[model samples]
Target: MAQSTEAIFIPHHVDEAFEVSYAEAAPDFGPLARDRIPVRSMAAGDLVALVEIDSRITGRKRVKYFERKLQDALSESDVRVSLVAELDGVAVGFIMARVDLGEFGRVDTTAVLDTIGVHPDYQHRGVGQALISQLLMNLGTLRVENLRTEVDWNDRVLLGYLDRCGFRPSQQLCFDRSLG
Candidate 1:
């Protein structure tokens, strides 16, 4: 896939705002070993696998959601950062992410971790870690400054996993207003 060539700009006043760079703040974890499972970029052919894995995890099939996610990953963004994990030739996990060249008035290059899912049978394995490791490596090459994700407050399992991956609470608080 082609990459964007636009110059990403960061506000000069960020330091005065006490903003922390995700790249510098993240703890240095040792290199990941990809010997066990093979992680690769998402492809148009893997749509079925992604849908299947997600369905098994959430206990319902959200076909349209996964379809749109896959489409966005493959065509909507300038960069393709989403990934899939396979074992014995079958897809067992997936992580879909996108790069934001800038948002609001700030122009820092950041990646948003949109959706991640591992088949029920593959939970507790190193599949998630491998996916995350590969993602970090990819982001580093593109000079992405940070990775951000949102999790429901009640999702203790996911929160614990993110903590283990060295992700801490973001400095900015998120506020949402319901339109309903």
Candidate 2:
């Protein structure tokens, strides 16, 4: 069978904003043996798993901090979380987002995909693309206007992914400092 690049083997449903119902249920996409990459909401109990994967893929120093923040963010009614490519209930990669229903000072409401990471062990396996594409599709489904994410210069893989999602690199800098 010709596999689908975008379709996940685990079973997934889209109701109100794509919040996960239960990790206990079979993945909406399908079996990992079929090479399908499933992206599902991450649970607070999954924090350690999230941190370990994120640190390796992002090459960042503060894995625990970010993981904790993500867990905290998920607690809010306005926030949402997602994970990707689970070999079986274990999280292989993940994405988390915040859908601010309130309009920004001068901007419309937005779905900010705070983080998306595929464990270094699973890079280049289309997990990252699947997760991002899923997130963008969800945003479109919600009729959101603006989407923004911060990317480090060192994380070129992520920058490239954003570009593929039709996000441009803005030339404007909010602030900068010099140590001279």
Candidate 3:
């Protein structure tokens, strides 16, 4: 067999040859499942469901705690920001938050996310994101500039989820003192 040399030429286009175009299907910025899930302000009727969801996650029922939170969320705030994610017309997840006009003499308005819970069956779905998205929208409309939450350092799963949802460490340091 005779040895032969072959040169393959590939075609290239100049920048001017074509107009800049975007992809027909837009990039996946984030999950759209959150939009499909129905997120709405928590109603007085949602307390039972909220307590059930929390009990499932924490292995204990805190009816009194949820009762107090729901009361404050519904009655104390002029605008309700706490939300529940519903699927099949049942509450599957909830985020309890409150708008603080000022804390420690800071004049800026901020939202304190006291608690969030999603049924185990709904975990890893967009239920949590939906609650957060609705909460953010509600807070934004109220002119609240910040949302803050505290998670135990040991709870890595919750930490990772919040991190994915764009939460970062705050500049303020929290302290606690024993009253006993």
Give the number of the best model, judged by TM-score.
1
lDDT for each residue of candidate 3 in 60-106, tens digit (9 for 90 to 100): 99999999999999999877788899999989999999989997989
Angstrom error at residue 177, model 2: 5.0
Ranking by TM-score: 1, 3, 2
| Collision count for each candidate, in order | 0, 13, 0
RMSD of 3: 12.1
lDDT of 2 by residue, 1-180 (tens): 112245334346555755643323422223332247666666667777777887786576676687666656677646463445576677777777777765435456676677776777787777766676566556666776667777888877667877755677655465678999
All candidates in order of lDDT, best leading: 1, 3, 2
**TM-score of candidate 1 against the unseen true structure:** 0.82
Q: In candidate 1, where is summed lDDT lowest over 10 consecutive residues?
A: 24-33
Q: What pairs collide in candidate 1?
A: none
- Model 2 deviation from native, Cα RMSD in Å: 11.2
What's each prediction's TM-score?
A: 0.82, 0.66, 0.81
What's the C-alpha lDDT at position 100 in model 3? Answer: 91
Alpha-carbon shift of residue 121 in model 3 (angstroms): 0.5
In candidate 3, how many Å is residue 144 off?
Answer: 1.2
Q: What does candidate 1's lDDT look like per residue over 63-171, in tens digits?
A: 8988898999999999999999999999999999999999867799999999999998988888888888888888888999889999999999999999987788988
Error of 3 at 148 (Å): 0.5
Candidate 1 Cα lDDT to native = 0.84
lDDT of each: 0.84, 0.63, 0.82
Candidate 3 error regions (>4 Å): 1-31
